[model samples]
Target: MTLNILSRQNTVLNKFIAQIRDREIQRDPMRFRRNMERIGEIAAYEISKTLRYTPRIVETPLGQAEVAQIDDSIVLATILRAGLPFHQGFLNYFDDAQNAFVSAYRKSTKDGKFKVKVEYISCGDLEGKTLLLVDPMLATGSSLVLAYEALCERGGTPAHTHVASVIASEQGIDYVTNHMPHQTTTIWAAAVDEELTSRCYIVPGIGDAGDLAYGEKI
Candidate 1:
């Protein structure tokens, strides 16, 4: 699996990232969601660089032009709620791409541990398609792996999977790297932090993205 961390570079994306991380700025739910959307747009643009393309001819008003156009079939799959806005970013760009949604939550165990369970999934056949699994936060990575497996179980395996997240923990990244398909998966993140809390939250990470984007769930 390949890991691509965007914060390693200097770009305007850093501004949106920093805004989402700021407690004051993040308090504005609208802005928070928009920032997530913005990040998603940027990520989609970067991911496009790796997709396969074919040359095509287009007729212009005065002449014909040759252009390289994307040939890959893209499916933008996102985790419920939190991944919605971020997923929209990708959609805003890949307007014609297919979409999938899966809902997974952590079921806490008595030993301060948890297991992820995927409850709902809506997707088309993923066979030979490029799946962009968008989730705003990757803390434990279990939910992500579980979600991917769930999609494959119902929709068949995708040709390649792009795991997209806004913020990822070191351990979470490691866990995902070990669990996902070695050669067919790639992880992309806007920023990667080092600490993971006992509660499975990324340290210095933007608090519950779902809650920040939507309202807190009971």
Candidate 2:
């Protein structure tokens, strides 16, 4: 699997990423959510470049013009709650793309460990389509892998999967690289952190994206 780190290059995307990571700025839920959405929009633009395109002729007011238009079928699948705003950013660009939602969370198990449980999934036919799995934070990666499996189980396997995250941990990236369909999956992240907490939170990472975007859960 190929990994694309957008922050590696300096751009406006880095500004949004910084705002999300700033504790003081995070106090504003609206701004936090908007920043995540902005990051998603940028990611969508970058991912669009890799999609297949075909030449099409269009009639203009004056004459006819030929343009290269996207030809690949796309499905935008996002993990619930935290992914909603991020998903919207992609939707703004790929306005006609199909969408899928999966409800997956970390359920506490014995000791300090937790297992990812997928409670519900809503999707349509995914056969031979390009899948964009959007999640704001990728700390453990288990939830993502489980979500992908659940999606495929219900919607059939997609031709290619693009794993999109706002921030990803090194371990999470490694896990995804090992577990996902290597040849067909590509990972994209705005930033990559090197540490993960014992509870599976990325260090120096924006704390609880879901909570910051919305509110804290009980």
Candidate 3:
């Protein structure tokens, strides 16, 4: 599987990692959220560097100069609640990019099994555009994949899709790699753990990203 795992080696990303990993820092909800946003910001820049860019003329104080600029339009989509801050980070960079949101919840069956139900999806047409789907955690990978499917079902399929996350389990990464359109979609994460809890939590993950970012829901 061609999985991209970013971590401490990338100094800028490492700072965000330290903050998120620090017990005391994680305790501060605002700081915790900001850290997540910071990670997103760094990730956004890194991803942008790889995208197709073309020379464009820009007016300077003295004269116009040619500079590289992103060519394809981008559509930033995030899972609700947890994804808000991370999404905001990408939005900070792609100010003019289209925005999209998806809400998928886990439903437990009578037999103790669970399934992902995509109840809400808000997106513009993604045809011929770049799609960035942000989810803070990737444990079971069901929600992320389902969210992608939901987006394509509602809007048109994207030319390319990029999945972003703070932490992911090895199994979760494998699941996405095997299920997603590998040639057109790529997965990016700061770190990948080896185990997943029975409850579908990544081991040593930053806890429930939604709860940590926005308090607990009743």
Instruction: Assess the local accuracy of residue 40 in candidate 2 as a C-alpha lDDT between 0 and 100.
Output: 93
Candidate 1 TM-score versus the reference: 0.97
**Which whole-number lDDT from 0 to 100 does residue 212 have in model 1?**
96
Query: Global lDDT for candidate 3?
Result: 0.87
Tens digit per residue, CA lDDT, model 3, 13-78: 888877887877888999988988988898798789779999999999999999999998899999
What ordering of candidates by TM-score runs from best to worst? 2, 1, 3
- Output candidate 3 Cα RMSD: 1.3
Across 121-145, the per-residue lDDT of candidate 2 in tens digits comes to 9999999999999999999899999
The number of the candidate with the highest TM-score is 2
After best superposition, candidate 3 residue 166: deviation in angstroms? 0.5
Q: What is the lDDT of candidate 1?
A: 0.95
- Per-candidate Cα lDDT values, in order, are 0.95, 0.94, 0.87
TM-score for each of the candidates: 0.97, 0.98, 0.95
Pairs clashing within candidate 1: none
lDDT accuracy of residue 101 in candidate 3? 93
- Lowest summed lDDT window (length 10), candidate 3: 1-10
